[model samples]
Target chain A: MRFKWSNVVLFFGYLFLYFPLICIVIYSFNESRFVSTWTGFSFKWYKALISDPIILRATVTSLKVAGVSATASVILGTMAAIIIARWGAFPGNTLFLGAITAPLVMPEVVMGLSLLMLFVGMESFFGWPSRSGNITVIIAHITLTLSYVTLLVQARLQDLDNSIEEAALDLGASPLKVFFVITLPMIAPAIVLGWLLAFVLSLDDVVIASFVAGPGSTTLPMIVFSSLRFGISPEINALATILMTILSIAVIMSAVFIYKDGNIKNM
Target chain B: MYRIEEIIISWFSELMKKIKGRHFLVAIPYGWVFVFFICPCLILIRISLAENLIASPPYTSLIEWISGYMLQIRINLGNYMVLFTDEMYIRGFATSILIAGTSTICCLLMGFPMAYAIARSSEKIRGILLMLVVLPFWTSFLIRVYAWIMLLSPCGFINNLLIRLNLIEAPLQLMNNSCAACIGIIYAYLPFMIFPLYSAIEKIDYTLMEAAYDLGSSPLKAFFSIVVPLAIPGIYAGSALVFVPAIGEFVIPELLGGAQTLTIGRLVWNEFFGNMSWPTAASLSIILLIFVVFPIVFAQRRREAKLSIVD
Candidate 1:
C-alpha cells in the first residue's frame, strides 16, 4: 500500500508539471479563434507566428543579446571559478565572492532597478552609452548569468583532481600553458554547460530586460509578455510550443552527448 | 589553419607574459563584478535616498557642492518612510510573504513524496525520472507561467472541459486570484524543491530503513524519525530557494493574480513604470532585499554548521 501510494503521488506530480504545457501545445493546433473551444485542427497560428515581424525582430535581438552575453559571461565566469577554486585566498577575496554570488539571490526587480540607475548615472557622468540599449541589456544579462556559470564551473573545478595540472606544471610547462592544455580541456564540458545556461537565462529574462531595454530594443520575452497582458492568443501558444520543442531538442542532444562522453571516458 | 592557430597562440602567450597570468586571470572578472554588481547595489542605496525629480533619470542629487567650498547633503528619508506609512505597500509585503510561504509549504508536501519515490526507484528509472523533473525547467520560465494562464483562465482548458461535461453552469473563477498565483508559484518552484530533496534522500542508506522495519517501527514513525531528520538540510535549502524567488516573483502574480495580489515585485514595477517614480521603486527594492537577505544568510550559516558537524 505504501509503495502504491508513493507511485500515485509521483504520477500526479508529473501530471501537474507537464499537463499545462501539453495543454498549450494541443491548443496551439486548435482551429477556433477562441482558445478554450476546439473547432478543428489547423497550423494557421504557427504560420501567423512565423509571419509576425515584431516577434521576428525581437527573436533576432534576443539571440544577439543571449549569444554575446553568454560568451562574455563564460569567459568572466571561468576566470572567477578558477580564481575561487584554484587560488587559495587573496585580498578582497570575500568581497569578490560576495559580488559573484549576489546576483544569484538578488531579486530581479532589485537588480534591474539598480543596473538601470547605474546606467543613467554613467550616461550623465560620462556622456557614453547615451541611452540604455542592447549594450545595457547585455551588461545586465552578463551580471545576472555570471553567477550561474561561476557556480557551475566552480563546482566542476573543485571536483577535478589537482594532480593533472600539477603534473603538467612539474613537467616544465608554464602555468599558462598548463592551464590552456590541461585544465581548460578538463573543464570544457562545464564551460559549455555554463554557456548554454547563460544563453537560456538571457533568452528567458523579461523583468531585467524590461527595465534596461531602450526604445526599439524589445526582446522576445518582452514581446510575448506584452501580448500575454491582453489575454490568451493562439499565436502565443504556437510560439510556446516552438520554444519548448527547441529547448527539448537541445536538452536531449546535450544529454546524449554527455552520455556518450561518459561511455568513452569509461572505456 | 595551423599557421593561424600558432600565431594566435603565440600572440596570446606573449600577452599573458606581459601581464602576470595569475593577476590577469583574477583581475578581469573581479573588476567586472565590482563595477557592475557591487557598484550598482551602492547606486541603488544612493538612488533610494534621493528625492524624486521631474527630469530624465528623475531623482535629485543627494550630495552637492555649494558655493565652491561648502557641501550640502539632501538626504530624503521620505521614500523609505512612505513604505512604512502607506497601507498599499504594507499590504503588498504581507500578501507577498503569505503567498510565497503558502506555496513553499504546498511544494514541500507535493515534492517530498515524489522525491522519495524517485530516490527509491531503480537506478535507470531514477535517471529518467530526474530528467523529467528538470526538463520543464529548461524551457522558458515565461512560457511555463503562461501555461498556467491557459489552464486556469475563465475561458481556459479546465473551464471549457468542466462546462462541456455539464458539471457546472458557470466557469469557475479560477484565474486572476491569489489562489491562482499560489498554484503558479508551487508549479514553477516544485522542481526546485524536488531536486534538493532527491539528493538528500538519495544519500540515505536503504538498509537503515530496513533496519527500522526489522525493529518493528511503523512506516510513518520510521519516516518521521529517520527520513525527516536526515532530509532537514534539503528542506531548508529547497524552502529558501522557493520562498526567496517566490517573494519577488513578478510575472506569476502580475498575470495570474488580480489587483488584490499586489506583490512587492509588481508594486515596484508599477511604481517605476506605471507611476514613473524611480525613488519609490528603489526604496521598495531595498526593503524587499532586506526581507530576502535574512533567509539566505540563515540558510548559509545553517548549512555551514551542518557541514562542520558532519566533519
Candidate 2:
C-alpha cells in the first residue's frame, strides 16, 4: 500500500524546516529594522553591511580562525589517522582512540573549560605563550577538530586495500618512501575532505571559543553573539547570506571529492 | 575458517610486515589527544575538590586540592556535596535532562513521520526529500537558530500569522523562553533525527509492509506490528544521537532561555567565566563527563556482549 499521506506530510515538514530561514532572508531585504514586519523591500541593510567595520572585522577574524584551525587540525588529524591505521592496535591504541574521539561527544562547556585550564597550565609551566587569543583559539580548534579529521581519515583509510603498501614494500622500498609515494597519494581525497570538515567544524564552534578566546580574538560566531546584545539586526542577515554561500560551496566541494574518490577506484 | 595455529602465525607475520618504520609518525595522533584531551580532563578530575571556585590554579597538591586551597591542594568533597545540596545546581541538571528528554521526544514524534514519508516516497522524490532534510545543515547553525528569535518573538511571523487568523487574542510569550528554546533545539537538530531514522526505515524491506497488507492487516496494524519493531533500533539510535547533544546544547539556551532558566551548559559556562570558579567549573565538567560517559560505556559494552552471544 503506497501511503499517499507520505507526500503531503513531507511537504509540510519541508516547509516547517525552511519557513523561518525564508522569513529571515526575505525580511533582510525589508526597509524596516524590525524583522517581523515586511515593509517595502530595499537593499539598504545589505549596503550598510558592506560598510560596517565591525561586521567586516568579524568576518575576517572568523575566516582567519577557520583557516588556521582547519589547517592545524588537518595536520594533527592526518598524523593521527596514519598512525592508527598503520600501527595495528598498539598498547595505547584503545585508550588513544577513546581520548581523541572523546572530544567529539564531550559537552562544549566541559571541553571549553578544560581546554582553557590546559592553556593556563601551559602558560604557567612553560613560562611563555602567556596570552590566550588567536594562538589558543587555533590550538583549541585543532583539539576539537582533530577528532573529526581523524575519524574521517580513518574511515577512508579502512576501506583502502593493504596490498598497495605490501607491493611497495616487496619492491625494497623503505617505509618512508612507501608511505609518501603510495599511501599519501591514495588517501589524498580523504585528507582534502577531512580538511574541509575540520574547517566547517572550526567555523561552527561557539562555546569552546568563548572560553579560550581572549580580548580581540572574536571570531564570526563571537561577533554574531555579541551583536545579539543590542537585539537582532538585518545586517546579520547580510552577513549570514555571505557565510551561507561559502559553506554551501565547501559542502558541495566535499560531496564532489568524496563521490569522485569512491568512484575513482572503480573507474 | 583457517586453522587456528596457521591464523595466529599469519597474524603475527602480517603484523610484523606492517610494523616497518616505528617512527614517531604514529605517535603524533595519540600523543596529541593524550596531552590535550586526556590530560586536561584528568587534571579537572584532580582539581574539582577545591573548597572554593576562585582558588586560582597551581593548587599545589592533589590531596590538599580536594579539601580546598589550604596552603596546598587539600582534599575536599565539598563541591560534589554542594552540587547535591545546592538546589539551583541540582535543579539545573534536572531541568537540562528534562529539556533534552522532552525535546528529544518531540524530535522523534516530528521526525518519524517525516522520515517515514521520505522513506516511502517514490525513489526520485525520496532523494529530493532527503536532500531537503539535510539542506539546513549546509547553512550556518547559529543563523538558523537566530531565525527563531524572529519567528517566536512577540511580533514574530508565527504570532503575527496566528493573530491575523484570529487564532489568539494577543501574541504569546514565545521568544527567549524555555519552550522557544526547545523549538530551536528541535529544529536545529531535526535533520540529525531524520537521517538516522530514514536510514533505519529505508533498511526495512517494503515487502514486509506489503506482506502485512496481504495478510489483511490494516495500515495502522501493519505499522504497529511490522514497522515499529524494525524501526526500534533506528529510534534508539536517533534518540541517543539527538538527546546526548541536546543535553549539552548551549547556544540555543543562551540566546533563547533568557535569564529565567539555567541549564547545566550555561551553569558550566558561568562557572568558568561568570562566577570565576575555575576549579569548581572544572570539577563540574569532570562530573558531567563521568555521568554521560559511564552509562554510555556500560550500554555500549552490554550491546556488544549481547551481540556476541548471537554469533
Candidate 3:
C-alpha cells in the first residue's frame, strides 16, 4: 500500500467510527463494576443485565415499539412513496409532500415537545388513547420515520422502469393488479430496507419517547439516557454491547441483501 | 403449471377490479400523516399561544364556549413575548445554533475527505467502506455517546493512557463541556455528511477533473473549480441534515455537557420535565423550529424545482 494521504484519511476515519464500538464491546466483558476500569474478562455484566428487570422490560418495550412502528411506517411510507413517484400532481399533492418530509428536517426536541402537547390535547378532547404509552410512542415513531421510508422508496420507484408495470396494465390487468403483482414486488427490497431503517431509528430514539412516555412505558434509550446522567455503568455497557451486536447484524444483513439485490450496484 | 397460472391470473384480475375502485391507496398514509404528524405541530402552535396553567394538562385552552351563540377564543401572545423577553431562552437558541453550526463544520471537514476517498476508490472497496460508515449508525446512539464518556472521564482511557505515557500531570476535562458535545455531534453525524457527499462526489464525471487537468489547472485549483461546485447540493443536504438535528440534540448535550452547557434542546427538556412549564417549552420549540426549518426547506424545494426543470 502506497502512503497516500487519502489512504491515511480513510484509515483514521474508519478508526474514529469503529473505535468506540470496539471499546464498548471489550469493556462489556470487564469484571470491574466501573465502566472505564480494566479488569479481567467476565460475563458478570451480561449476567446482571439478564437478571435486571428494568433493563429487560425496557428492552422489550423498545423492541415492541420499534417493531410496531417500523411496520406501520413502512405501510404508510410505501403509500406516500407511490403517491410521490407515480401519482404525479394530484389534489393536495404539494401539502402531502411537505407534510411527509417535514419531519425529516424537524428537530427531535421540537417534534417531541409538539407531539406531547398533541397527546395532551387529544386526551382532553377525545378521551381516547387516554394516556401516553406504547401506543403513543409507536405513533410518534411512525411519524418520525415515515418521511425516511418515503424518501428511500421514492428514489427506488423513480429509478424503476415503469415499462414492466405498463406492460402488465396493457395486458388487461387493472392498476391494482399491476401494483400488487408488479410494482410492489419490484420495490419490495426498498420496502424491506425502509422497514429496517425505521426499526433502527425507532429503537435509537430517546428524546421523542422521553416526552411522550407515560408511567411504566420506559424504552431502552430512555433507560440508557437516564442511567447516563448518574454516570456510566458496567451493566449499561453490557446492555449497549448486546444492542450494538444485534443492530450490527441487522445492518450487515441488510447490506448483503441490498448488494445481492443490485441496490448498491450503482453506488 | 399453465392451468395454475390461468387460475391465479383470473383470481388476481377479479381481485384487481375490486382494488381499482379504491385507487386512492395513498389516502391511508396521507390521512395518518395529517392527523398524527402535521396536526401535532399545529397543536404545538396553538398551545404556544395559550396561557400556562397550573392544571393536569398544564395549559389553558385557547377556545371557550361562553354561550350557546358565541365562542370565546383566547389568543395569548404572552408565551412568545416571554420567550423573547427572557435572556435565557435567547442565549439557549444562540448557543444551540453556534454549537450545531460549529459541529456541522467539523463533521464536514472530517467527512468530506473520507467520502472523496471512498468515492474515488475501487468498486469493491467503496461498497465495504460505505457499509462501514453506515454500520455504526445502527448501533444505539446513546451507547455511542456513552463510549465517549468512557474514553474521556477522569479515570477513562485517554487519561489513563496519557498518564502511563507521562504526558499529563492531571486528567483533562474532556467530558461535560460544549467541546465534548461538539465532538459527539460531529461523530454522530459524520456518516450523515459522508453519505450525501459520497453520492454527490460519486456522481461527478471524472472526465471533468481530467479535462481541467489537461487544460493546465493545478489539482487543487481543479478540485475547487470543478469538484466543489458540483458537490454544493450535497453539501447543502448534508449540512441541513447535520445542523438541524444537532441544534435540537438533547441526549448528546445533556450527557456530555455539564451544568453550564445549555442548548435549546436541553432548555426545552428542562422547562417541560423539570419546571413543568409546558407552554414555555412549546413556544421555545416552535420558535426554534420555524426559524431554522423554513430556510432549509425552501432551499431544498428550490433545488428540487431546478432539478426538475433540468430533467
Candidate 4:
C-alpha cells in the first residue's frame, strides 16, 4: 500500500505536468477552430501559422533578441560568477553580489518598470537608445537573465577544484592563459547551461518585453499574450506546438549529452 | 574537434589579453550590473517620488538647482497617499496577496509528495524524474499559461471530458475564475517547489528513517517527525520562490483570472499602460516592493548572521 501510494502520487504529478502540454500538441492538428471538440485531425493551423507574417516576424525578432541577450548575459554572468567564486574580498564585493542577485528575487513587474524608467531617463538625457526597441529589449533581458546565469555558474564554480588552475599557474602560464586553457574548459558546461537558460528566459519573457518593446519590435510572447486576452486561436496552438517540439528536442539532446559525459567519466 | 577547440582557445585567450588587466574583466560585468541593475532600481525610487504629468516623459522632475548651488528638491508623497486612499489599489493589493498565498499552498501540497517520491526513487529513475519536472519550465511560460486557458475554457478539455463521461449534464464554467488562476499558478510553480524540496529531502540520511522504522514508529509519524522538520528550509525557499513571483504575476492572473480578480501586477500594468499614471504606478509598485522585499531582505540578514556565526 505504501508502494502503491508512492506510485499514485508520482502518476498524478506527472499527469498534471504533461496533460496540458499534450492537449496543446493534439489540438494544433485539430480541424476545428475551437480548441475543444475533436473534429477530424488536419494540418490547417500549421499551414496558417506558416503564412502568418506577424507571427513569423515576432518569431524572428524573439530569436534575435534572445540570441543576442543570451550571449551577452553569459559573458557578463560568467564574469560575475568568477569574481564571486574565485576572487577574494575586494572593495564593494558585497555590493556587487547584492546587485547581481537582486533581480533573481525581484518581481518581473518591478524590474520591467525600473528598466523602462531607466531607458526613458537615459534616452531623454543622452539621446542614445532613443526609442524602446530591440536594443532596449535586449538590455532588459540581459539584466533579467544575468542573475540566473550568474547563479548557475557560481554554483558550478564553487564545486570546481582549484588545484588544476594552481598547477597551470605554477607552470608559468599567465593568468589570462591559465583561465582560458584550464578554468574556461572546466566551467564550459555551466557556461553552456547558463546561455541556454538565458535564451529560454529571454524568449519566454512577456512583461518586461511588453514594457520596453516599441511598435515594430513586438516579440512572440507579446503577440501570444495579446491574442490570449481576446480569445483562443488555432494559430497559437500551432505556434505552441512548434515551440514545444523545439524545446523537447533541446532537452533530449542535452540529456543524451549529459548521459554520455557521465559514461565517459565513469570509464 | 581538436582544431575547433584550438581556435576557440586562441580566441578566448586573445579576448582575455585584449582587456589590459585581469581586473578589467571583472570591472566590465561589475560596471554593467551596477549601471543596469542597481541604477534602474535606484531610478525607480527617485521616479516614485515624482509628480505625474501629462507631458512627454510624464512626470515632474524631483530635483532642481536653486540659485547658486542651493539644491531645491520636490518630493511628492501624494502618489503614495493615493495608493492608500484609493479603494481599487487597496483591494488589488489584498486580492493579490490572498491569491498568491493560496496558490503557494496549492503548489506546496502537490509538489511535496512528488518531490519525496523522486527523492526516494532509484538513482537512475531519479535523474529522469527530475528532468521531467524541469522540462516544462524550459518551454515558454506564456505558452504554458495559455495551455491552461485551453484546458479550462467553457469548451475546454476538462469540461468536455466530463461531459462525454456523463459526469456532468453540461460543461462546467471552469475558465476565467480564481480557481483557474490558482491552478495555473500551481502548475507553473510546481517545478520550482519540487526541485528545492527534492534537494532538501535528498540530503536526509535515510538511515534515520530506517532507524525510526526499526523502533516501530508509524510510517506517517516517521515522515512527519523525520522528513517534515528537515525540509523546513526547502519549504521556506520554495514558498518564497513561488510567493514573490506569484504576488506580482501579470500574465497568469491576467489570462486565467476572472474579471473581478485584480492582482498587483495587473493593477500596475493598467496604471502604467492603461491610465498612463506613471507616478501612481510607481507608488503602487513601491508599496508592493516593500511588502515583497521585506521578507526576502529579512531572510537574507538572518542567513548572513547565521553564516557569520559559523565563520
Q: What is the Å distance of residue B13 in model 1 from its true position? A: 21
Local accuracy of candidate 3 as per-residue lDDT tens digits, B194-250: 988999999999899999989999988998999888887788888887888898888
lDDT of 2 by residue, A1-267 (tens): 357687678878888898888877788788988755678979998899889888788678778998988888888887888777777778877888888887777888888888787788888899644554588888788989889888877777888898989998999999879878988887788788778878877888888888888887878888888776456778887777777777777776666666666743321
Instruction: Tell me model 2's lDDT, rounded to 2 decimals.
Output: 0.79
Looking at candidate 4, what is the lDDT of residue A99?
Answer: 85
- Quote the positional error of residue A184 for candidate 4 in Å: 1.1
- In TM-score terms, which candidate is top? 1
- Give the CA lDDT, 0 to 100, for residue A240 in model 2: 76
Name the candidate, 3 or 4, with the larger lDDT value.
4
- Report the Cα lDDT for residue A12, model 3: 97
Q: Tell me the spans in candidate 4 whose CA falls farther than 4 Å from its real position.
A: A263-267, B1-20, B66-71, B167-170, B298-311
What is the C-alpha local distance difference test score of each model? 0.91, 0.79, 0.86, 0.87
- Candidate 1 chain A has its poorest 10 consecutive residues by lDDT at A258-267
Write model 1 residue lDDT over A1-267, tens digit each, in one string.
Answer: 877887898899999999989988998999987865678999999999999999999999999999999999999999899999999799999999988998888999999999988888888899766554699899999999999999988988898898999998888999879988999987887888889889999999999999988987899999999988877899999999999999999887777776666721211
Ten contiguous residues with the weakest lDDT in model 3 chain B: B18-27
Choose the strongest candidate by lDDT: 1
- What DockQ would you assign to candidate 1? 0.74
Question: What lDDT is obtained when candidate 3 is compared to the true structure?
Answer: 0.86
True contacts kept of each: 0.81, 0.74, 0.85, 0.77
User: Best candidate, DockQ-wise?
Assistant: 1
- Looking at model 3, the pairs that clash are none
- List model 4 lDDT by residue over A1-267, tens digit each: 777898899999999999998989999998998755678889999999999899899999999999999999999898888889998687899999988988887788888998989898899889878554699999999999999999988888888799889898998999989888988887777787788889999999999999988887999999899999976788999999999999889877866765665631211
